[model samples]
Target: MELGQASAINFGDAVAAPQSGRRAQEPAADATADPGVIETSIPFRLDDLRWSGFHTRVVLALGITWVLDGLEVTLAGALSGALKASPTLRFSNLDVGLANSAYLFGAVLGALGFGWLTDRIGRRKLFFITLALYLTATAATALSWNVASYALFRFLTGAGIGGEYTAINSTIQELVPARYRGWTDLLINGSFWLGAAIGAGSAIVLLDPAVAGPDLGWRIAYGTGACLGLIVLVMRMWIPESPRWLMVHGHPDEAHAIVAEIERSATGHDRAQRAGTLPKIRLRMRDHTPLSEVVHTLFVTYRERALVGLTLMIAQAFFYNAIFFTFALVLTDFYHIPSDHVGWYILPFAAGNFLGPLLLGRLFDTLGRRTMITFTYGVSGVLLALTGYLFSIGVLDARTQTIAWMVIFFFASPAASAAYLTVSENFPLEVRALAIAVFYAVGTGIGGVAGPALFGALLDSGSRVSVFAGYLFGALLMVIAAVVASRYAVAAERKSLESVARPLATME
Candidate 1:
């Protein structure tokens, strides 16, 4: 129950104790005290198994992080006008932008901080803890009496979701079978759009003057997000720690037990069908991997791969943040669409974003990571460039512009989701969570922060050419990232994580 302490979690009838407290003072070579080394072929055993009811539970529980994020983002965009109109908060247009920025800043910090703990403490503990933070903070947001309080609550909410990224994404990647990894990861990430659509639909109802007053409507919207977080929290409690994480941390007995239970759940009495498939591996179980070794793993041992991840992350962050945050402003300002009606347009856009990942996910495994990453990023970039050009020339109206955006994002969403998938899978299991945190923090800090600020300024200028130029800049970044991915993207499709980047402590 306490922070930084290990807790035992129950999964069905089996219980596994996650890593507890600091192992910092322990010597790495003391094999007898902490069980020196384990070489695990256990993960491959999982890779060979067929999909089951267990996998479904894991995906549904873990995948909601993205959905909650999408929902929050959509709500923020849709309710901007409502917030500005409210007598209670009396927020300005710029204030809404600042609140969003605060949330992102908090998320970046949360990812780094909780990400380190996820690698050090354990996965199961962090997932629910982070969700609780989101639930508490978002519920508090509904009670905000001023702009400052609202922004503070939003920051905490973002922090909770941001932490979820490191814990959930790493856990899912480690647990799911390699054959289904691409599709599963894409589906989970794309589920964010499902949240986005829900938020949009909710906003249309909540923002109506007849249904609710301006002051109460936005408060209810915040409460709705909090309620969803509570639901995810209950589901997350049913999930367990990553067995792969257990094996790396010198608990192979516990790891094997957990995997055996899953196998039983997956196979029932048919366990003998794949009874001998697990491979034996030897890995040195140090109480902790030194910080220097983590740095070496990410930047030194895998420098080129690290660059590819950074490029992809920065480009995608810029593209999504720049457009998504300012989408409503563009709709209302440039095309004269009513403020309250923007949610209707967002629904179709979210649908396009969701479908891209669903339809194209399998190709990441079938066609290969390099080809698919390039095609998606490159195609999306070109489409965005052309769309921006059309808008600048004054040939498109609100309906046509929305249609163009839907098409551009149909490809862009999957490409963006792949950026998360790429970084999470590229590093050693020892530092997977921290590595994801580093890249996410760095990428979101640089591109995510700058994108909105840059576009907000451009959008405010009300110059068609200026805003058009911002879109081209985003497009150019995506093209550059696609080129980087082509050259350095790991041939990781359907391969085990250990194979993609061998664990640092792998012994014989």
Candidate 2:
């Protein structure tokens, strides 16, 4: 075993050797024991990704997905006033709900469909295909001639959006360092809503016509979103392949190549030490395995992990879908804010959105997964329900509205990022992408369809105040999700991804 570099591990001096096959925590781990002899804090080939960098890319990608999603859905929000006022569109509250939901119903199909695509094909390759498809979908959304036509186009767009939730999250977790994974993933996830704020904010600004005649604001907003997605296609080129996936799927050489490049990135930086330290370093490359074996590893032995992904995804999509679809309507109809100032009011949501990952992410590790996520779900729900109720009761003055909105935004923040971290950490390298996609796709798809259906009914039949109570139910779902998470969710950050093992999962 080669040793004695300044960062090298000293076998005799280090703690008990790490067990075999435990995944590397961070590439920045001070030293490594060979995988055959020990497992904790092993090194990865690439070092530049700083787990944070990996998260940054994921956040950026999801941000685009979320922006496009917000854009696609906002067709309903942005044009609602017009649709409601115009006799031609003949829109009703129920119609609006169904239109909002149609996209989500399509997303349900999209998530499952794309999950299969990610699993069968490859994560990195599938990203471009999904993005391009969504961009085309977004552009086409601007051309809808009727409610049914609009709903059909939106549904297709939802599918592409579904692909984004699953694929980008899976890729980021596979590529980033473990130390900062939670923090970064949460930050990235929060940016999805920030993208939403962008979508709506842009809609607010672009509502005026450039050439006079009819107001082309909503269409222009969709166009801007589509163009931004095209820009995303170009930006994604810079990101490298997943080192973990390369290592697990018969690409050890490629994995090492990525590892070496990352190592070069680490040459000048300070190394992050592991808790209780380990033995001297030895570089031993791992055995290559077929994709079939990887697939079996996840579905067969790691079903519990899959459940975690699936359940949490459900919670995230349910709450998020409900909030995003309804909030704009709530602001305009219940509060009666002028359409122009609505976007400015939502800009603060960006603040709450950005804050979740940057600040609350630390609690995932510090407070531990069970405690933090449970609290996150509980608190966010309470706050959101209150925000809804406050808006309904006229208790929120303008300043108070922003404050309450900020609070509610903070509540919405954690699930987006926190859940991704959970999904990624729960599965092994071979099927990391697949697990993430399945989890998000199913959750979002299910939630997307159900949330709007329920809310739309409330929006149509009764006092507008009842709609906030419906939001309360959505928040309550998070509490249930928290229970599921507490019972089923394993602590991924405390351990390495490779260390994951279910009750019946004995390694060969």
Candidate 3:
């Protein structure tokens, strides 16, 4: 299918037909008709297409990043005992906590640096770069000879995964249809639990003295993620760059071709003929958005949305990181649960986390974003407070404690996933990736970085009261974020990206 010939439409005018024939080459730096100022229906056509195998491929390939992150985190938590027992580098409770913090700190820096580049460059390029870093760093984690070495490798691994969040979330939001965006993003983010489950299961066998021994088992676990990263690299080659991104970045012809190809693959024919009736958006193409514009867009133009995003991200970061990073420590220190058996407890917890999104994610699209986000966050906070109280009073045993956590996280998982969803979709296209990175970095730095260390110190005290205090703090943050979301969160359900937040480069 050919794009209709370029028409003499005025600036800000909507061209009813697909922009004419493909240019022999990309537009010159100053050219307007060939690329710069052409109006196109790419976004509308993309959102209108039916889901197909192509969408499935994209989900499987890009969605795997969360799984890798989950695996890394769970291994860190579950391997706390093995690290302490290792002859080469025996770790204290504080050492384990510090390592986890190092990873989060790395993620903070990675998100900021790569997120800026994702916006300046393109999504497709960053995917490989981040994955390669993750693969190399995780493998190196297996070779660490000391606590400092281990922390450094974990930090690098965190950076890779952190970068993955910006690029993958941005691409997913841009590629998915508006109707499916909420559930798809939540489920993909929630897939982190699937990795958690995998890590838990691996720990059950790998950490067993008879199977692999303490040191060998943990090392192998880190190596597993590296192997998985290699597979992910191959799978990503088939995915294309975001057409919405291309459209506003002076590649309308390439954008048109990609949309047309997606149409043929998804519908078995070019849908460009029907595009004449679809709505068109005019964009002034540019090489990149200036940092000053991005700052203004987030703080001045969309300040309220920025506040909501930061609150959600900060709350979830603390709630998840504080508890999850030190899960095995609590089990071993308080209840005398063996290190190898901690995975059994995690499996149930991971199940609850994953199922929450799978079951409730559709509601974000149906019941609406504000209403659902408020409900999930409130429920999770209340449950955590109650659970923390029970544990403080010595009323819960190892089995019962895990059961309580399973129930609490069932609500919290989707709540956490929604934080990412909120930040990624609420910003304009040009700064979308960087905005996510900034919120994640700030939130993680403030809430995530210190959580595990704080909790680790609490656990070391052996005072249930001290631990309960930490839980209460996290619960409070969640409750506050829920209230803020109810009052200010965007009701962005089932809306196109352009409608939710217009592109910064839009002509009119």
Candidate 4:
């Protein structure tokens, strides 16, 4: 497995071939014509591809980013107890919140910077850069002696994960066929809970006084992410650059070669005969899209979709980050659950989160995107409100509170995953990655960055009412976003990316 190797074989046949012994005509040359103009059916080819072992590999290699993020977040939450009780670093609730905020703030910046480059450079190139950064930062996190050092390392780690979101999401969207795209994307994004489960299990063993004391357990937990990252780097070497991206960026020959290779792997022979019937799209190739055009496209050309993406993203970001980041604090402060036992509660919670998308994901493709997204978001919001009311009144113990969360997030997990799916798929190919970054940055900046810190303060006050107020606000945002999504989300299920949103460079 090397760079440019045909790792994730996409669908469909090669470029449209000649019919009845007549060769296809190239774009006619004119003085005013764009020199890079060419016709291709690469998008169709990709969307028509059947699922194969190659696609499975791509899902495993690329989708691991979400798992790593889940692990990081869960560890942060699970280890809050250890961090606070540490002899070397006694972090207050506000300190923990600030650290979590710093990680998100770094993610916002990382997504903006790396996402811009993901669109500029090829997706394959950025994969290693982001993963390498994550590996180094997470490894360094094990060496932190104080809160400042820990926060700095965590910020760097977040930067890497944020960059991974843009690059990996773009690649998954481009490579996966349209029929399987919705469920595939949801399941992959939801795989984060798998990592959460792993982290919880790891915390249980590592934090145990018999195995390793509080100080060493948290350090070892951070080290595990770096080890997993190394394995991911090797797996990614087999994945080639996106053919549709290549075809649009003046590399039609390379695009054709990759697709042909994939077809051979998929069908044991080139289905060149069928190419004649496939539709073609003419594009004026460019090295990169300008920032001005990117801004205009997001805000003006697709303003309505942009609004929907923003609302969904902001609502989910706050809803998830506020509660999950401060999960242990809530349990410890209100319920008096010991730090070591937190992992037991997290296990059931993680199971529900993961199962949400696994069980409900197909409905997004079948019942349609708008219907599923709205239902998930609305249900999650309503459930959170009910759970908050219970918590505030002291009617729910730790066991009951964990049960409540397990039920609530069964919907919220898919709702959160849908936010990423919506943003990545609704935009044009030229700006897809950047669109994800912009929405993620803004959504996280406003909702994610503030949510944890605010909740931490509310929890620090030791007042159930204050925490309930925060929960209510998060619920309100989710409901409002659900309304917006119902009204405006693109019904992009089972449609080709090009058909859903026309490419910017498409020539009439």
Best by lDDT: 3
lDDT of candidate 2 over 252-308, digit per residue (tens): 344445544554454544333421243222333334335576667666777776666
Give the Cα error of residue 170 in candidate 4, in Å. 0.7
Q: Mark the 10 consecutive residues where model 2 has the least summed lDDT.
A: 39-48
- Local error of candidate 4 at 122, Å? 1.2
lDDT of 4 by residue, 1-508 (tens): 1211221222222223222222234333312233466566677777777998778989999999999999999999999999999988899999999999999988999999999999999899999999999999999999999999999999999999999999999999999999999999999999999999989998999999999888999999999888988999999999989988887777777788898787777767886555545666767778899999999999999999999999999999999999999999988889899999999999999999999999999999999999999999999999999999999999999999999999999999999999999999999999999999999999999999999999999998999999999999999999999999999999999998988988898877
Kindly report which residue stretches of model 2 are placed more than 4 angstroms away from their true locations once superposed: 1-43, 46-64, 70-76, 83-90, 209-215, 266-308, 387-394, 397-402, 501-508
Model 4 lDDT on a 0 to 1 scale? 0.89
**For model 3, the run of ten residues with the poorest summed lDDT:** 9-18
Every model's TM-score: 0.92, 0.79, 0.94, 0.94
Q: Pull out the clashing pairs in model 4.
A: 11-49
The deviation in Å at residue 234 for candidate 2 is 1.2
Q: In candidate 1, which residue ranges exceed 4 Å CA deviation? A: 1-34, 270-277
Q: State the lDDT of candidate 3 residue by residue for 358-390, as single tens digits.
A: 999999999999999999999999999999999
| Candidate 1 lowest-lDDT run of ten | 1-10
For all candidates in order, the CA lDDT equals 0.84, 0.63, 0.90, 0.89
What lDDT is reached at residue 296 by model 1? 83
